[model samples]
Target: MGTSAERTGLPDTEGISALPADVPAWRVLLSYVRPHRGALLAGGVLSLATAASGLVLPLVVRELIDNLGSDGPVAELVAAMAALVLINAAIGALGSYVLHRTAESVVLEARHHLIGRLLRLRLSAVERHEPGDLMSRVTADTTLLRVVTTDSLVGGVTSVLALAATVVMMGLMDLTLLGVTLLALAVAVVVIGLVVPRIHRAARHAQESVGVMGAALERMFGAFRTVKASGAEDREGDRLRGAASEAWRASVRAGKWEAVAGNTGGLAVQAAFIAVLSVGGARVASSAIEVGTLVAFLLYVYYLMPPVNQLASAVTQYQVGAAAVARIQEAEALPIEQLGPLPRATDQPIPSPPPRLQPTGTTSAPAAVTFDRVSFRYDPELPVVHDEISFAIPPGGMTAFVGPSGAGKTTVFSLIERFYEPDTGHVLLDGIDVQAWSLTDLRAAIGYVEQDAPVLSGTLRENLVFGAPGATAEEVERALRTTRLSAMINALPDGLDTTVGHRGMKLSGGERQRVAIARALLRRPRLLLLDEATSQLDAVNEAALRDTIAEAARTTTVLVVAHRLSTVTLAHRIILMDAGQVRAIGTHRELVTNSPLYAELAATQFLATAG
Candidate 1:
C-alpha cells in the first residue's frame, strides 16, 4: 500500500499537467462511478447547497457593516449569524455522507471486477506477471482510487462553485478590484498548470515502485526456507531494503512537486489579496466604492483561496487516481483461459469403472489422452522442451514415464494439464482437440497431484475437500483410507479438523503427500496424473505408499512421472525420455537390456547401493 505521505503528496501541488489527449483516463474512471450516479448527483446537489450557504455569509457581513448607522435589531444580527452556521454544518454533513458512501461502493465494485478478471486469466498470463504485482493492483491501487471518488470529486465541485460565486459577488462590490484579483489568479492558474503534470509523473513512478517492492517481498517470503538454508538472510534483507528505498525516493519526489504546487497556489492567493487591498483601498478613499462593500469583497476574496487551493488539489488527486487506474486496467486487459458453458457436475457421484489394459501398438481407437507428434517450448528462442513426442494412455492402466533429471519428464505432465500449449502438433482428449475443450471441463476430468503436495492455510477437512467441494463425509473417509491417511488423521490432536498451518508445514513429508493423494482421490477422476513424491522417506512409509499406488491403479488410469528407480520398476510399461524426446519404450527389464541410457541409470543406482 502507498504510505500516508504519498497519499497526501498531490493535494499540496501548485499546477498539474493537462491530461493526455489520446485516451481519456478520467472518462474511464467515471464509468465505475456510473453505477452510483444517484449518490453522486445527491452529493453534487448537497455541495452546491453548501457553496450557496457559504455565499450567504459574505452577504450577511456586508448587510451588517452597511446598516451599522441604521436602527437594525441586535437580536436579528445574532439570529442571522446562527442560521448561517447551522446551514453550513447541515449541508457539509450531507455532502460528506453521500460522497463517502458512494466512494465505498465504487471501490467495492472495482475490486470485485478486478478479482473476477484475474481469476479467469490464463495460467500462462498469470505466470507472466508476478503474483505480488497483481496483488498490489487490487489492494494498494484501489485505495488511492478512493481519494478521487470521495474527497476530490465532492470537494472539487464545491470549491469551483464557491470560487465562481465569490468572484461574481466581488465584481458586484467593485469591478476594478475584481479585475486586479482576476489577474493575480490567472498567473496562479498558469503556474499550477505547469506543476500538475510533474506531480502526475512522480505519482505514476511511485506507484510502479510500490509494485516492484511488493514483488521483491513476495519472492523473499515465498522461498523462506530456501533462503534460511542458504544463509542468505542479510542478502535478502538488503534486496528488500533496496526495493523499499526506491519506493520511498519516488514518493519523496512526488511529494516535493506537490509541495511546490501548493505553495505556489498559496503565493498566488496572497498576491491577489495584497492587490485587492491596495486597489480597493484607493477606490474607497476616492468615494467610488463604500467602505462596507470593500470589507465584504475582501471577505469573499479570502473565501476564494480555499476553493482555488482545492481545485489545484483535485487535479493532483486525479493524477494519482489515474496512475492506479492504469495498473488496474493492465490486469483487466489480460486474455483469460476460455471456459465454455459446460454443466457443472459437482452434485453427481463419480462412478468407479474396472481397469482394463490395452496394448501400446493396438489398432484400437485412441484413449482419453493422445499426444500426437506434440512439441512444446516455453520460450520461442530456446530449444523445445518436448520435441515431436507421441504417446497414448489407454482408458485404464498404469503407464509411467521414467528419465534422468531434465529429461522432459515433468514437461509431459505440464503438457497433459494444458499449462502450456504445444508449439507443433496437437494433444487430444476423447478425439477432441485439447484446446477445443474448455479448460475447466478438461481439468475436471483429470486429477493431478504434484510432487510437493501444496496445502493451503486451513483445516485438514478443508484441504481434503478442496478438489471436490461437495464430497460427502463418507467419501472423504474412503479417500483417506484409500491413501492410508485415515490412521494418521485419527492420531492428530484435532483429527480432520486440525489446522494445516501455512502450506501444510505442520505435516510430515509422507503425510503431506498422502493428504494430497486423498484430495485428488476425492475428485475420482478417470485419469490421474501423479508426479511421484520423491522426498526421502523411511522404508515403512515407502512400502505403504507403494501399496496405496497399487490400490489406486485398480480403478483409475494412472500416469506417473517416476523419479525413483524402484517406483519405475512397478510400472506395467515405462517410457524413457531424454533431451525433449522419447528415446525408448518398454518394461523395466526390457529397457535394462535394450536401452543404454536406461541401463546406465540402473547400474549407477546399483553401484551406489553396493558401495
Candidate 2:
C-alpha cells in the first residue's frame, strides 16, 4: 500500500509520519497559547505577586529576631507576617483557577480543529491509517495540550523568575552561604539535564503503544460475530492482552525517568539546607554574621524548594507533552478534501425538528458520464486496475457491467465518485472534467450504493432519510412502498422509528439492501450507481425491485454491476469486460451471438434460452 501522502497527492518524506521534523516542540505549544495570551498573562502576574509575598516573610522574621531584646512588644510584627501569609494564599488560589480555565479552553479549540480536519480528510488518507489510531490523536493526544499550554509554558517562566529573585535575596544576606547553596544544586542540574531527553523518547513510545492497543480493540469489535462464530475468544483475548502489556511496560519506563527527574530537585534542596546550617553556625560563632542574619538565611534556603521543584516539574511535563504534540501534528498533516464553504456553528437555539436541507441538484434530467482513456492503480507497485479503458453512458436508462471478478467493475463507480483519482486520463460528468467540478456539486448530483449495502447504526427512519435529510414524510413513505419494505416496517412495533442494530445486524441481508436503495431514492439523484444492489433479495422481491429499477431508469441513469442472469436481462445494454479492458457492448441477444465470453457465462447459468 502507498503511504498517505503518495495516495493523497501530499508532500511525502522518507518516513511514514508527515510531522515537520525541523519545527521545535515549544513553537507548536505556543500556537495553542497565542489565542489566550491575555488570560495567561494575568495568571502569571498573580503568581509572581504571590511569590513576592512569600519572599518578604523571611525578611520580616529576620527583623523580628534582631529587635527581640529592645522591642517593648513583638505583637505588631507577628500580626504583619500572618496578614502576608493570608494574602499569598488568596492570590495563589485565584491564579490557579485562571490558568486551569485557560487550559480547558485551549483543549476545546484543539479538539474542534482536529475533528474538522479528520472529517474532511481525503478517503485515501483515511484508508492509509487505522481508525482507532486516528481516534487516539483526537482524544488522548489532544488532552496533553492542557498541561503544555499552562503548567509547562506559563509555570516555567514564573518558576525561573522567582528562583532568580530568591537567589538575589540570599546573596545580600551572606555570600558564603549562597556559594554553598549553588554548589549543592549544581550536581542536580547536571543529573537532570542528562535525564530529561530520555523521558521524551519513552513517552512517545508509550503513546504509540496505546494507539496500537486501541487499534487491536477496534479490529476485534468490528468483526465481533466472526470471532464468536469461529470460537476464537481465547485467541483474540490473548492478542488484546499482549497489546495492553506493551502499553503498560512503555508507560512504566516513562514514569521511572520522570520520577528520577522530579525527586532530584527535592534531594538537592535538602543537601543545600544541611550545608547552609553547618556553615552558618560556624559564622555565628566567629562573629562573621549575627544569629538573626543566619536565621533569615536559613529561611531563604527553605523557600528555594518550591521554585526548584516547580522548574523540575515543568521540564518533566514538557517532555511528555511534546511527544503528544508531535502525534497531533502528524495527524493534522494528512490531506483533506477541498469542500467548499460551510456554515459556522453558533450558540443560538435551533428549533426542534430542524428545517429541511434544500437539494443541490437543479434539474431532473439524468447526468451523462464519460471516461476518456482512464488508466489507474491504487499504488505504484500494484498492477493497473483500469488500462486506458474508455466507456460512456448517455443521459438515461439502465446499463449493466458484466465480467469475471477483478475486471475493474467496481473501480468504475470509484472513479465516478472521485474517491481516488486516475493516474492518467479524465472522468467527465456532463462533458465537464470531474476534476474541474466542485466536489460538493459533483457528488450532490449522484447517489451511490456499494456492494455490501451497509447501513449505519440508527433508527429505520433515520437510515431512510440519511441521504436526503430534508425529505418529507410523504417522500419517505413512498420510498418504503416502492422498495416493498412498507409491510415489514408496519409489522414492527415502532414502524419507521424501530432501531437498526450496528451495521443493521437486526435486519436480514435483503432488508439492509432495500434500506440502502430507499436512502438513495430519497436523494432524487440524477445518477444512481448500484453495485450488485439486488444480489441478496429473494426471487419475489428481486422481481419486484427489477421493475422498480426499470421504472427509475426512465428518468434516472442507473448503472448496475450484475452476476445473476435475472438482473442482467433487465439492462438496456450489457458491457462485457475481461482483464482491464472493455471487450464488447450490446443488448443481451447481441452479446450472446457476438461475444464468446458472454455466451459461455449465459450457458453456465442456464440463461442462454432466456436471453
Candidate 3:
C-alpha cells in the first residue's frame, strides 16, 4: 500500500489533505479558538498593555535624565520605574495564562473530534488507511498543534503589538530615526517572505515523517509475534530505524530554515540600530536633534529588535501551524459512515413471521435476511469474492456454509453485516433493502464472531458488556455460562474484574473465543453469524463451542462458515461453496452421498488424519 504522503502527493511538510478546499484551513484552526474568545481577548489586551508600558519607559528614562537636578523628585522617578516593572510582569502572567489555556483546549478538542470521527468512519475507509498514520494524527500532529496554539499565537501577537508600539514611541522621539527603523524592518519582511514558505514546507515534511514512522512501527508491532517466530526481528528493527531517521532528517531541515529566519531578522535589526545611532548622533552634534530626544529614540530603536525577532518567529510558527492544520484536516476528511436515526416502535407494529420459523421473540420478529444474486469484489479490478451468490435464511434455523480457504465464506458474513456493500444485486432485510435500514439498526439486529475472536483491552466485565452496554450483571453471568466460559471466569483470580491485555493476548485462544461469544450473546441478536469460531480450537474446545452455538441457534438464527467437518455435520443444511459460488446445498450425509466435491473433501480430511 502507498504511504499517505505518496497517495496525497503532498510535500512532506504539508501533511495530509483531509479537508475539502472549500473549507479554509484557517477557519478550521480558528474554530478551536472560538470557545475561548473571551480569554484570548483578555490575553491580547494584556499583551498590548505590556507593549504600551514598554513604550512609556523610554519616555520616563528621557525625562529622568533631562531633569536630573531640581526639576523632579528622585522618589517619583523611582516610583514610576517600579510601577512599569510591576505592570509588565502582571501583563506577562495574564498573557501566559491565556495562551496556556488555549493550547490545552485546542489539543483536547482536536483529540476528541478526531477520535469521534475515526470511530464513526466506515470500516472500509479504516481498512484502506494505515492505523499508524491515524495514530500519528492523534498523537504527534496534535502535539504540534499545541505549540501552534499557545507559543506560536502568543509570540506572534506580542511581537506585532510590541513592534507597533516601539515604532510609535520612536516616531514621538524622532521621526527620521523611526523612518530608518521602518526601512530596516521592511528589509527583514522581505527576508521573512523568502523563508516562511520554506519553513512551512519543511515543517509539513517533518510531520509526514512522524506519520510514516508511526505506520512503520504499527506494522511491526501488529505482527510482532509472527515476525519474531519467523526470525525477522532484525529486519523489522532496521525498517523502524529507517523511518525514525527519515523523521529526524525532516525535522532538521525545518529547524535549519527556522534558524535562518531568526538569524536574518536579528542581523537586520542590528544593522538598523547602527544606522539610526550614527545618523542621530550626527544630528544631535549639529543641533538638528535634541540629545535627550536622540537618547530616547535610540532606546525605542533598540526595542524594535524584539518585535522584529518576534515577527520572524511568528511567520515561522504560522507556517508550522498551517502544516499541522493540514494534517488535522486530513484526519477530519476521511469518509465517515453515516448512521441513520434510531428505529421507533409503532402502535401498528409489523406482523410477526410464523412462530416455528421465528428466530427470537426478544423485542419483535427477527428480520429475514436474503442475498439476491449478490456479487462482491474487494478490489474493482480483481475477480469477485462472491459471484452471483444467492441465498435465503428463513426467520429461524441453522445454516452452515462449508468450503475450503479462499471460497469466500467469510465474505458472506461481511456482506450480511453491510461492512462492505455488494458490487451488484441487493441484500434485503425483512423485505426492505439493507441500505434502507440504518447502519446501527442493521448491525444491532445481527451478531458476528470472527475466526480470530478479537477482544479489546479491558476488564472481563467490560468486555462482556461491550456489545450491549445495558446488559445486567445477571445477564452477563448467564451469557458467560451459555458460552461455557463460566469455568474460565471462575478460574480467574479477578473473575469479572480481570484485565485483558492488548487484543486479549493475556487469555488463551479458547477463552478469548468464549468471551467473544458471550459478548455477542449479550446483544441478543436475531441473526448470529459465526465465522469459523472453532477453526483454531482443539477438539475438546471445539465441542464446547459447538454446544454453545447449538444453544444460541435455538433462540437466534445461526449462520456459520464451517471449517471443520465436525462443525458441518451439526448443520441442519450445508451450502457447499467453491470459487465464490454455491456449488451445492444439502445435509452432510446427503452431500456425502450426492455431491462429488463434498465427498472428496470428507475423504481427504479422514485420510489425512489417519495418515
Candidate 4:
C-alpha cells in the first residue's frame, strides 16, 4: 500500500526536495540508517566491544612488566593476551559482516526506489533529463550509500567511542601528559573540519561531471546514424573527449581534498607523539609516574591516534557520500504527475483502476468524438496549434484529416489522445466530456500510430502484439494480412519471429509502417488513430491499406492523418484543416467545389504528384 512517492523514490514533501540535499549530513545519513535500526545497534555494540580489546594490550603489557621475575608467568599471560586478541578479531569480523550486509540492502532499496521514481515521472519531466545521466545516477550515485552507511557512518561512531575510552584511560594514567597530547591534537581536528567540506564539494563536482560525460555520449550515440551520415565522428569524439577530461579533472580535485584530509590526521598524530614523549620523559625522571605506568599510558596515547584518525577519515568519506545523496535526492523531488494533483509519497498507493466498459442499453449509443471550440498549444509563449477550432468525426466510418504541415491536423489527434490538454474549450468523446473520462478508460478505447511508426528492437511478433498483449495468433495473422505485412513476414528468416533491429531498421520504411498498422489492428480498439498510415506504402500496399481501413470501419471508427489526399479520396468523409481551423468538411468532390484550400491540396504538390 505504499503511495506513488514511496513506490517511486519521492519523499513525502512538496516541490523539488532540496531538503535531503540541504539537510545536515548526519540527519541525511540517519534517514538511511533508520530502516536498519536493530542491525545498527547490534553492530555498533559489537564494534565498540572489539575496539575495547585494544585497551587490553596495554593492560597485558603493564601486567607483564609488573610481574617480570616475580612469577615466570609469561606463558599464562601470553595465552590470556592471545585469547583476547582472538575474541576481538572474531567480534570485529562479525560486526563488519553485519554492517556490510546492511549496506548492501540499503543500496538495493535505493536502486529500486530510483528506478520506480524514474518510471513514474511524468512524460514531460523525463524528456527534460538525459536518459544516460539519469541512468548513471541510478547505477553509480546510489552505490555511495553503501560506504556512507557502513564504513563512514557506523564505523565512525565506533571509532569515536573507542577514542573516548582511550583518552579516559590515558588521563587516568597521567593527566598532564594527556592534556599536552590533546592540545597538540586540537590543531589537527580543526584542520580536518576545514578540509572535509572541500572533499564533499569536490566529490559532488566529480559525480556531476561524470553524469555530464554519460549524457553527452548517450546523445551522440543515440543519433549515431545521423552522425555517421554527416561524417562528424572526429568532431563528436573530441566533444566526448572534452567531457571525459572534465570528469578526470573533477576526480583529481576530489583526490586532492582526500589527500589533504588524510595528511591532517597524520600530522596531528605525529605532533602529539612528540609532545607526549617530551612531557612523559620529564615525569619519569622526576619519579612522578612509574616506568610500567608510563609505558602503559604511552600505549593508550598511541591507541588513541587510530580511532582519532579514523574519525577524520570518516568525515572525509561522508563528504564524498553526501554528494551522491544530493543527486539521488534531487531526482526524488521532481514533480510526479501520476500521483494526481499535489502528488506526494504516502502510506497508501493509488492502485491501477479497473478497466472501463462501454455502456450497452437501448438508450445509450456509441460515442462520436467532438471538439467544441478547442484551443491548444505546446508552449504558452508560442502560437496556438489548435485555435478555438471545432470539428466532429462521427463513429462507424473512416474519417481522414487533410491539411498542410503545421495546420493543427496532428494537434487534433494529440488532443483526442490526451497527450496535451487544450487551453480552452471541450473535447468530447462519446457524448461525454473527455475530461470526465478516466485516462485509463479514454486510452483503452483508442489505438494510435505516429507518423514515423516506431518499432522496438525485438521479434516482429512482439511489435505486432505490443498494443494487445492478449491477442491470439490467428488475430495476429489476420492483422498482418490486412496491413500487407504477411508478404514481408514470409521473406524474413523467422517470419513474425524475426528481429526488427533498433527502431525496426532491419525492415523497410513501408514494412515498418505496415507492422505498426498491424499492431494497432490487433488491439481491436473502438477507435483507431493513424497519422500518415500509408505515406510509406507503394501503390499496391497503399491500395491494400485503403481497403483494410474501409473494412475495419464497418465495425469501428478509423481516423487517419492523410498525407496523400488521393489515397483517402474515397473515404466516407474528410475534415480539411488549414492554419489550425476546420476550413471545410466534406467528400472529395464537395471539398473540391466548396473549398479552394482543399482543391489546391488535392491537385497540388503532395497529393497530385504522389498519385
TM-score against native, each model: 0.88, 0.90, 0.90, 0.86
Q: Which residue runs does candidate 1 get wrong by more than 4 Å?
A: 1-23, 151-154, 341-367, 534-537, 605-611
lDDT of each: 0.77, 0.85, 0.78, 0.79
> How much is 491 displaced in model 2, in angstroms?
3.6
Model 1, 397-498: lDDT tens digits are 678887777888887878777777778877776655666666776777778889888888899999999988978887898788776788888988899999
- Report the lDDT tens digits of candidate 2 across residue range 180-250: 99998899899899999999999999889888888888889888899999999899999999999999999
Candidate 4 residue lDDT tens string, 350-409: 323323322331111224889999888777788878888988878778888888889998
- Candidate 3 vs candidate 4: which has greater TM-score? 3
lDDT (10s digit) by residue, model 3, range 490-567: 988999999998788788887898888788888888788998777666677678778877867776788998767777
**Selected candidate, larger lDDT, 1 vs 4:** 4
All candidates in order of lDDT, best leading: 2, 4, 3, 1
Model 3: pairs clashing at backbone N, Cα or C within 3 Å: 12-204, 12-205, 13-204, 13-205, 14-204, 18-330
Ranking by TM-score: 3, 2, 1, 4
